[model samples]
Target: MTTISCTYTGDLHCEATHTGSGATLSTDAPLDNEGKGEAFSPTDLLATSLATCMLTIMGITARSRDWSIEGASASVDKLMSSDGPRRIETLRVTLQLPEALDDDQRALLQRVAEQCPVKRSIVPLINAEIHWA
Candidate 1:
């Protein structure tokens, strides 16, 4: 299992380090949460994770099938609840795939994207609307 460590850097910001790779990232509270929105907020990371995970898995699947999925891109819009615990309400994802793929390949990649680990891990209450093109 991979391990990541994080340290609070004060002012609603934090620094996280990927233990194995020594790569680091910083996060800050969003402007709506009473802090400077200079970096990715915690919730932003969650949505980012979903998009990245889907693309990575789809790429792996395509490689295994001897297909090219180069230039595939995805965008995610994270929506937060207006009331209560201030949690994510929806993650709308739009994926634009290269035109080189056929219908069967598209279907296969779609299935792979849905089965991505982050997609499965997200709470059911959070609506993940996936649009592909």
Candidate 2:
């Protein structure tokens, strides 16, 4: 298992470090949430995690199968709830492939992406739409 440590840096900001890699990232409350939106907010990070996780999983599968996905890119749009509680409503993702993939390969990659840990961990209420580009 991996451990992540975080510290509240005040002013609705926080710094987090990944224990395994010593990698670090910062989070700031969005302007709509009462602080300056100078960086990715916590919810933003959550949305990012989903997309990144998908890509990472797909990459792993591609490598294992001797397929190439170099230069692939993705975009994620995080939509927030309009009523009830403040929360993510949807995570719309668009993935741009570096090269055309065969039907079987595309199907496998799509399955891998949707089965990513982060994607499965999220609430079902948070709708996810994966688009190809």
Candidate 3:
């Protein structure tokens, strides 16, 4: 397993370091939560993680099949719950696939995107709506 190290900075901000590559990223609270919102909030990262993971997995699957998945894109919309802990209740993702794919390849890529590791990991907790075109 890979390891990620995080250091909490002040004012709802923090830095995360990827141990393998020594690359780092900064995170801050969202604008609604009172921080500067200059960077990605934790919740925003969570949403982004899902979208990126799906795309990456699909790319790998396409490559393995000798298919080119270039120009494939994904969009994410996160919904926050109101009554409870203000947590993310749903993530709606729309993937615009390259028009060059055949119907079978398109269906295969869609399945791969939805079955990625992060999707499985967050299943039953976050409602994921996946749209492919």
Q: Which candidate number has the best lDDT?
A: 1
Which runs of model 3 end up more than 4 angstroms from their true locations? none
Q: lDDT of each prediction vs. the true structure?
A: 0.94, 0.90, 0.91
By lDDT rank, best first, the candidates go: 1, 3, 2
The TM-score values for the models, in the order shown, are 0.96, 0.94, 0.95
lDDT of 3: 0.91
1-133: candidate 2 lDDT, tens digit per residue: 9999999999899999999999999999999889899999999999899889989999999999999998878899999999999999999999876666788998889888889998888858688888887
Question: Model 3, range 53-106, lDDT digits (tens) per residue?
Answer: 999999999989899989899999988887878888999999999988999998
In candidate 3, position 75 carries an lDDT of 92
Ranking 1 against 3 by lDDT, winner:
1
Q: Which residue pairs show collisions in model 1? A: none
Whole-structure CA lDDT of model 1: 0.94
Candidate 1 error regions (>4 Å): none
